[model samples]
Target: MTEALATLSRAYRMRVYPTRDQARLLAQLVGASRHVWNWSLAKRTSAYRERGERLNWVSLSREFTEYRRDPERPWLATLPREPFNQVLRDQERAFANFFAKRAAYPRFERRGGRASMRFTFDQRRQQVRDTGGRWATVDLPSLGSLKLRRTEALNGRLRSITLSRDSAGRWHGAITADGISRPAIHVPELDAVGLDAGLRDLLVIADGHGTRRVPAPKALASKQARLRRYQRQQSRQIAAQMRAQGLDPTKPCPKGVRLGSSNRRRKTQQQIGRLHAQVADLRRDALHQASAAVVREAQVIGIEDLAVKAMSRGMGRKAFRRSVADAALGELRRQLTYKAGWRGRTLVAVNRFYPSSKTCGACGAIHAALKLKERRWACPACGTEHDRDENAARNLRTEALRLIAASSPATPRSGESDARGEAAAAVGRTGPAGLSTSANREPTVAGSGAKADRRQRQSRPRKTRTDRVAVGSG
Candidate 1:
């Protein structure tokens, strides 16, 4: 029987050039959206304060409609209903995230940051087509047809198109689409590997055959001097601009006094923004290339989940902030995760506290006194000399294989051959289940005894793909 394909959602972002009239309209839409968000938040907070009742999207939306009809607010009536409605939906999502503890309370969005407005309409009515020229246009609800620089053809079902203005004063559009491609099926034996990510060597990989190392691009480091020069110049320009307007440079801007924007200041700010964007682009490109290579080679891959947030804290010289920031470890892991999921592969992040470096892979002996600078060490138990990163990669592979073995229903019983054990390990490697450990043993799930769990696994039928465990350190 053929396997059913899983559909994935994808988004494409591109630079957009708007005419003078369209630019005005876009600005109006952004302003209207911000107003709607602020107004809805105020109403919700007031209701909660007075009646101890929370106002949901439906209530806020109803109030929004009522407010639009008021003669005092004629500008609200001029704004497109769809984008304005999207503002309410965005706020609702924000509140949901806050309540769920995924994010902090939704603050009112200020105008000067990145300005964006998402166009909303029924999918059946939306039209996105290429003009065969250098441009393409998408039909928005109230904005009509908007042209953009066409590079690739827009495929799949259109979900939404968002127009945004960056801090550098450039406008761009992003189109999100769904049901583009099917998830890939991975071959276990050829596609199972382990990774060790660090500053010295960006990634150390260990497949069944051997190991390979990928060096860090150090994009940020390369451009830091240039960026620092630009930043210093921008700071001087800001202070001078503030002084010209008779405002205190060190103190905050007065309550209602808005500073005038000069061409030179704007140009300087844009230069800084461009440089920042260049470094970001380079870093992102490098990560994508590295991640794509890893995913293409391995279906079941294990990596360390480093505590980047904690590591970035403090001002110590040994803290290695520049290395940590330049490494972009978190971003690398994030790319590997979603890409793996999209391709029907498994990407496991080992527990942060797992001492892959301290534990000897050959003898399973823990060396508590091993320091970071000691790149190589000799194990006392087995008299084996181990390269720090290489040993860690091998241990990660072994631990990952063990995890795969424990999760499999077909794990070899006592007296089983090593070859069959390896095959049994291969069978379970492509599943979502991941391995993590404090020592060498597998962490028990729930409260079931190991014997009872083994018996249960032997008795029960195989589960569907959706029922399988998610890829993460349990």
Candidate 2:
């Protein structure tokens, strides 16, 4: 049997530079859409509570259409209604997710946060056009052509584009497209490597050649002092201003007394936002480069399915948790997942409990009592010394290769020995039979696409990213 040609919906985030008037209009557009969402939500709540009526997106949109068309509300009539339609569609999905227990109930869109609007591609308006080179132009539903910049030219059919305003007052657009060409496959299938993620070392990669380590980039730590100073200065400025207004600095302000804003305060806040964004950009840039390097070289990449949240909770020190978060371990894996899929490489996720650290790479010896502090140790069965991270990486590569072989169309897995299925659902929890560190039942064979049953939702064969990294640096 032949495998189907795979396709992906890739999204790109580009910087958008809008004129003064366009910026004001963009703000109005997002504000109007927000108003509609809040109003529709209120209407739905009232209908359900008072008249026992349920209102979906269609019904809410119909009412909004009539409401906006009234001569009394010229403010709503001037703006294009297409973006609001997307808002309604999003609201509908939100409600559906809530009912299905996938998300919380839809909330009202408020002011003074990240303002955004979604516009579907319509050829004339709401289209993305590449002028030439790295520069492009985007036309939202109502906003005229806005200057845009990206590393690569827009290719294939433009699906829909979403524009947003961040706290720093910068404009950005996320353009979704279809049929875009992915990176070419150049490596052999046997070129597999294992990646171990940690705070001490960003990544310890093991391959046929040897083991290599990448140092961790503690981006936040580098700027921690600056961030703390800014925060303290902001706090002190606020308290001083409040005290000047004859209000208690320590206690909450009275409802009637409003603390006014100043250019100084606003400037301080924006500076903080810029710093935070810089740190994030630095971290993300590093992750992208690392993942790209890994994906470009290897055909099969094995990685641990790290439970970062659980791992963070186990750490007693705030600094430890902060370090774990700044490392962006999960983000690295996410990048690897999509990049590998795009580049025609295979990314295999080893179960977290796989004892990669405890198991010996040279000999299959399990050191149950291995401590976390022991960075280097010798195998009990064979006296070969090993670096903990390097050993773990080698083990992961072996497990990933085994799983891939077992899941192959030629393997014909059956009965109780499906290594791929076990890698997906079991194997890590327990050791060998009697010597098992943890005991558990055998997992069922995991198929490509699972459908929803009575209790749980369907499982997907693979989880791939819909967004691709920028072709060049931000």
Candidate 3:
């Protein structure tokens, strides 16, 4: 097993910029590919409707070739078979995934706008230039002698290359390879860290070392503003174009507008899309770095599996949604899992129900109530003050460590696990009414009967002063 594991490899992708002619060829390839995809999809849909099951790519390609020979479909002959084959393969995968419940029904690819193509290499001869300098002799099919700017070092056997165009009118090639090794693990002491993800701060890390705040990049906000401005400009231009064309400018335009008439609007839309893509790329890069840092430094990393969907159902839903989208907490978790696995580090997840925020870190006592508005609080039991975010981070770290200890062969000698078990049992003794208390009561007297009494009094109706006065007068 160890030998097989040692033989196992890794894969990485690097973006490469191509020359102008290469970009044009890429665009043409993408258009032809999309055209092939649409035509094949239409034929397959028709066939499936008439004769159960869709036709295979080979058969379809043969038929397409015959159709191309016909004078009526000369445009089909002009289409590149390589891209057509690629599209057919993509459609096949899409259909297979849809049937497997892995993805939704395949959507038709848009033609000509942002062209792309894929290249696959055998296990051997996968090596390509990566000198960070322009290549003079690299060969690309149908587009020869293309200059490429290498962004990152390539490792292992090259498997595939996918070339795509950005909305910024830039061309990029993604080189996929195999046989890469996992990054070296930086094993630290069994110190665990908890992260609280938020809008104001990207991540709040808490550990035995102390609390630290990692703020989101200012560039994210700036790029978002730029994207919005571009989008607004594009919208106005599109509206004006619609008005000039004797169409209802307010109504949504159809999928492909008259090319020449809406050229400028289309260009603006592309610019806006490019800006969005840039922002997304920036966020993804940041997330990778942050996740890698945590995975490298911590022996065990614990984070909340926050139900972002449920949390978004609030008064300020847009803001919450934006926060969730910006943080990409789920993506962070994903990266941590895979990266940790590679490094043989532990990635622990605290239960969503865990009251990390409400729980006092200094004491084991859980706060009965903690609102989002409260940024800081003092633990009544321990008399320990805490920044709310920091408190949550501490709680997460402790809980994660506890979880890891319980799951591992090495149990703590202090019987903390036994105490925790007893505490959990005690929680169960309080019943359903008790659950509400923890979710709603104040931090000071969380589990006390006084809280229950106060809640009851609060729920009950009070007699009016006028009624009391009338009774006294009578």
Candidate 4:
């Protein structure tokens, strides 16, 4: 499909500078939204537990509106209606996801968590106005046109605006738009590749070109000592402050602790938060660069559908396990999945239970006795020594090729036969016949509109910013 014709939903997030009063208003809106969510969740839980009745979004919203209007909670009326309504809609979505078995039960929003609120636009009443030259203003309900640091032309039809605050007290605006123009596609050199993710190596890729391993940065591991020290100091300060206030040091801080003025405890906590953010940023940067590199090189990318949560479970090799979790394997997979789609590439996920590690690549021998520590071993049947990760990567490639061949009947016979034989050999090494990899049974993760005022917007020449990247770098 052509770039303009193909429909796509995209989000652009930029740092927004709200005035002092506007910032206070935004904080109030976020607090009110959190209150509404928690109240709705409590109501839903009560109804389900008491009478086995279900409370849907609409009913909860209607009831909550009346509650807000009541004299008991007159302060709710001070908040904007749009953000409050959006909160209810989000709560409804949470409940729907829970019912569909995609997520756990909806939980109450905490006070000190990441604060955010989304506002839908009614073009007739309010919309984002571009005040010319890389500057635009979003007309929030209570807080008038908040200035956003725009770096690109907002061409598409605006859908919603989400305002969020990071842990470091910086506010950002994420604008969702539809029918954004996509760039032209680039044909890559390699047709297919298979990746095996692990703690030592973030990913091991086996492709037609060769095998490549991306080492994990271990960001959190590298900064753990510093983080622990800051955390310990923060705890000590908080306990001492609590005791100075005539409160028990061992017990929880008295209510309204956070409502107090700035102190050493708060500053220390901020330091710890900044460290955590730094680690997260490093990990994200590494994943994005690696995933983009892989996606740019291969058209058909195959990755194991790992149950990272299951892998992280248990107390075996705590440090190693923690490193695996910190590697953010699932996040990498998620990034690859979406990036592949955007770049017009195919991403195939191998079955999680598939023994990519245990099977032999050279002779297709199944090393049933292979332990986690056995990084290299000789295939008992074929007598070929193999590196465990390299073998798994090769097996993943073989299985992926077999899957592609089975799906596409017109593929070359020699290539198909090679993949089939290698795959069958790997399966045969496992046991007997009928033990083929379940490529066909890949688990499908239970995973818009708008035209424009014609050619006027498209006819405008694209602006190339010399000083900055695109607004939506992701």
Local accuracy of candidate 3 as per-residue lDDT tens digits, 1-474: 464354434444345556676666667677777777788888888888888876777788787677667787666565545556667788888878877999997777765454677766544552365444644224555665545565446666666667777777666666665556656768445467898766556688987789998877889668766766775686677678777776786566766767244677768767865775676566667778888888667766777643434343432425433444423555565566555544545555566567888898888788777666778888878988889888888888887766654442222223443343223223212111111011211101011112322443465443110000000000
Model 4 TM-score, all chains together = 0.41
lDDT of 4: 0.67
lDDT digits (tens) for residues 1-474 of candidate 1? 222246667778888888787888898888888888889888878887899987899988888889999999898897789887888898889889988999998887787754898975476665777777768887776677788886676667778889999878778988888877664766355457778866566678888887888776766456645666776787688778789998887875668887788898788778766776675566567778888988777656776654434344443333533334423555565566555544445555565567888889889998889987788999988889999989988877777666555564333233333332222223222211111111221221111123433344465453211112322244
Q: Please provide TM-scores, in order, for all candidate models, with all chains considered together.
A: 0.43, 0.42, 0.40, 0.41
Regarding lDDT, does 3 or 4 come out ahead?
4
Better of 1 and 4 by lDDT: 4
**Which portions of model 1 show Cα errors greater than 4 Å?**
1-5, 183-474
How many collisions between residues are there in candidate 3? Answer: 1
Clashing pairs in 3: 369-441
Model 2: lDDT equals 0.68
RMSD of each: 26.5, 25.6, 26.9, 27.7
Worst 10 residues of 3 by lDDT: 465-474
For this target, which candidate reaches the highest lDDT against the unseen true structure?
2
lDDT of 4 by residue, 141-258 (tens): 7899899989787767789999999998899999999887666777444567888776567678898866888876767446645666786786678677777777887776666775
Model 3, position 237: C-alpha lDDT score? 79
